[model samples]
Target: MSVIEDALAALDLETKVKLLSGQDFWTLPAIPEIGLRSLVMSDGPIGLRGIGWRPDDPSIALPSPTALAATWDPELARTAGRALGQEARRKGVHVLLAPTVNLHRSPLGGRHFECYSEDPLLTGEIGAAYMAGVQDQGVGTTVKHFVANDSETDRFTVDVRVGERALRELYLAPFERIVGAGAWGVMAAYNGVNGSTMTEHADLQIGVLKREWGFDGVIVSDWTAARTTAPAANGGLDVVMPASGDPWGQALVAAVRSGEVPEEVIDDKVRRVLRLAARVGILDGAEPAVAESARPSTLDGAAVARKAATRSFVLARNEGGLLPLDPARLRTVAVSGALAADARVQGGGSALVQPAHVISPLDGLTAALAGEQTMAVGARPPRTRRWSTPPPSATPSAPTRAAGCRSPKVHSGPTSPVCSARPAGASSSVRRCPARTSAGWASRHPACHRPTSPSSRSPRVSRPPWAARTSWRSSASATSR
Candidate 1:
């Protein structure tokens, strides 16, 4: 028997179940008796955001996946992946939860920037290259949102009713390609595909991904995505993530005892986890797929990122002979737009990471056009003021107030805080107010109104539900891209 099988044989049902559930937000429990060590995971595809979200421990931020795909160079994508893999090793991360291969099915998808492209073939090739590069460095990669997580609208509950033909040809193509390219992990998305939730979707996760395609790696649920013990286990979800509200642990052991989930099924899951551990060099006896000495040498992250950004630039239209503006002839240059000043380095959520520094377009142009008078204007006032995470001591129950801002009530929804009205006697100066909540600050915005608790606050910012559309649109009179 293989080392993985021997280790699985030694583990009891409860221990095996424990190994399948994450001990915390970014790691799984280690079974020392079986020579298993804790497996650490981090967010990736752009940069490696280790375990914490802090500015001091910043990561080397790369261009968005969309930008990388625009370059149409799979080799470049592979190089970018190598950089990320190096970052992962430096931070003690074994698995990178990234390289989102979901197709750009809708323009309005909230995470469109995070995905590669609308074309499945392009996305697949790029994703495969990226995965290969990361794995080349001895780290594992999870090509994510496993099949058809194209849009964010009601994503957790919406049952995407896609026909088998569309699924095979379009939605599932990228995952199929990536899996075939030897992906080490797959994240089961939150939403249901067709009539079944992906975590419990046996037909695809087991029948297609494992039995047919022969994916040997672990199938982990997207954080907190696994909702049932037996169904998810039997359906082929190898692991449930983050200790919070996990469906697998003791519940799974009970399911096994009751025969709801077979012990052999548990063994299969454990076998995959142990195999992944072996590949990452965390398990004892098995030879790691890539040795530490074989990893690619140190990479210059900034240089690689700069090259990628330059290559990805697509000049949509440079009408007239305006081509490259002659620096000698140029007397004055104008830069406009709020985005020009406060550039969003990356999309929000899992893709967010603090780079050591971000060179805004205005700053870049200003440096290049030195001595040439540069004028900058915002179409709207740059959102200078915003909410931020309060110190650990400050909580919703304590109700701490920011200097010159009112103590607003904390709410439970995932909406951003908006100051509907200016606080009484407050100056127009920008203040970094804390939008306190049980889940930390959900969002931050320019402070204008007093912060209210959820109990006292009235419904504010009443716009049509569709007002929060993801597409960029401007008025007919406006003159900006």
Candidate 2:
């Protein structure tokens, strides 16, 4: 038997099932008897955010996935992937939960900025290249939100009703391409497709992804996505993530003993998990797919990020040839917008990372026009409710109340940030505001309250005092008149 097969043979039902569930927020438990080590994973489509979200261990943040897609260069995407792979090795990460290949199906999609493009072909090509580069550096990559996770509207419950033709041609195209390119892992999304939840969608996960496309890697659940022990196990979900509240572990062993789930199915999942561990070089007897000597030499992360950012620039209509402004002829330049000074270098949520530094447009232009005068205009953008760490004294069980706003009362969790608040008389039941508008927070709740000031149109919540301070570094150049 092969090394992976041998490892699988030695594991009992409970040990096998345990291996498929996360031991912590970012890792899987290791069994020393079988010569397997803990497998570590982290968030990344742009950069690796390792286990800790602390600033002291910052990552080399790259441009958003959308910006990388705009470059239209598969090679550049691969280079960016290499940088992330290098970062992964430095951070002791075995797999990168990245290269989110979900298509940009809607302009209003909450994660549009995190996606590559509206075009599936382009998304597929770039995704394939990015996945290849990461794996090339001996780090595994999960091509994610598998099969029709195109939007975030009611993500956890929304049933994405898509026809097979539209689904195949548009939504599933990129995933198919990446799988064909031999992706090492796939993350099952939170939503459902047609009527079945993705985590329990056996027909697609087993039938299409594993059978039809022949994906050899593990299919892990998006954190907390696997809701049922039997359904997910039977549905071909090879792994459930992040340990906390996961539906697997002892429940799966119980389900198998009860005949609701087959032991053979559990073995198949264990086999896949072992395969992944072997590829990442955690399994003792198996040779890693990429050796240390084969990896590309050390990369200058900032240089790679700068190149990708510059190449991604798409001047849609330079009718007056106003761009590439001649510095020699320019007397003064005016940079505008709150983003110009405080750049949102990357999209929010799991994709967020603390870069060592950021280059605000204002600083970049000011440096470029060394002698020329530059003026910053417009007020800093209103702070919308985003995930930020609470004060040190705050506990996950603590209740955060937003005064006057009819937002739902939110409780912080051990692994997640608390970014919501509730009004004085709002229902105590936990609920989130439906959505946020550019103008402000929008809600259908009758008791909804608007922000007091015009600038605070969005529901206002307290943020860490240090978050308000602006720190800028000089890098890249942007011109505006």
Candidate 3:
């Protein structure tokens, strides 16, 4: 145990981490010199990051948290916990960041499909189940996004700004129960709670999580989120993750040395991390069995997907007859969205899974309608025909087809750009939108169209392209229209 403690002393924090990795725990690394323990981390309240868990690592995914909660069985939660823990063991992963226990504030949460219900009790019950199983398997489980990591948009910067009563009653409850159930670790969010950063706010991390609730587990800073290391450490955050490729670790050591922070603070923080590692058998002499041949399920894992989809489908309005989608007599469907083909089952960033195959609403609906008899009983099935719109024909246009292959972006630009298109069963021809009124290119486009106010200009980007291009005098003038 002193190995880590002494490393913390003589070796710089980076060197300490480097040394930890140098001591291999299990499965060999692709780069042996980098070492097996260079501090492995994983996602998935459901399972390991099988894709990048490591090429040599063997671990498959389990059901999403939402699906697991549907079983409403703590045993399932524990099994899920055990499944992930076993998977964690396979990879020699030190931290399994998971069990997103944030209360379901709204059904609109994009990631909620992977999370539990809007009720804190349900979230707590399920989160605890996962925490128990993962820790039991000798790999640490980190109950995550600590306080109010509810929304996906602007998640890192949103100011939660809630009252103490509301925070305790709703958002913090699941974490409290999970802590009580022995979650060995926690991860703080990037958002500000009531004008204070969750990582630096001594009130929640220290006053509430540590002292009040008695959470002895390690508190991890959200990836790239430890702004003031000293304040965060003093606030009860134990780890600054995900060991960003920068000199921030060096800064932490320097801060400790310069008396900006006390070494005792570092000791306390590191102790928490070490204690969990010890609990999870990381520092033990056991030669953890390296997982063999385990990878994320290649078989679409439709069972898991359908199960997850079914559980996440809330019955918000049972007003009368809007139940199961009718499979019979559902013909001549007028579809609109391109998303039907490319359904966004998951979000864009870190949580994405390279699924073996994706089943879109179009695919599901098609299958449903295909073999069924007519709306009437035993009637012969109707022949189904599907076709996208035919491209227009007019002036000579840009080549929008690759060897006559049609693409969606073909119509993205100015209608006047004249595009060569070939709809199925139609002869190749140069074409444009039908109406004489053309859709011309504005600088920013879509958002720039029909601006109501100057303040309505692009918030993320510099300014709307058309803001200056158009002859609008003032913001008031723009809004007046």
TM-score top scorer = 2
Q: What's model 1's TM-score?
A: 0.79
- lDDT per model, in order? 0.74, 0.74, 0.54
Worst 10 residues of 1 by lDDT: 472-481
**Cα-based TM-score, every candidate:** 0.79, 0.80, 0.62
- The digit string of per-residue lDDT tens for model 2 on 181-287 reads 98999999877777777888999999999999999899998877767889788988999876777778888889999999999998888888899999999999899
Instruction: Evaluate model 3: give its lDDT.
Output: 0.54
Task: Write down the TM-score for model 3.
Answer: 0.62
State the TM-score for model 2: 0.80
> What shift in Å separates residue 115 of candidate 3 from its native position after superposition?
3.1
Task: Point out where model 2 deviates above 4 Å.
Answer: 372-380, 387-481
Deviation in Å, model 1, residue 383 alpha carbon: 6.5
Tens-digit per-residue lDDT, 18-95, candidate 3: 321112222211222212133456665545664264445434445557766776777656656666676666656766
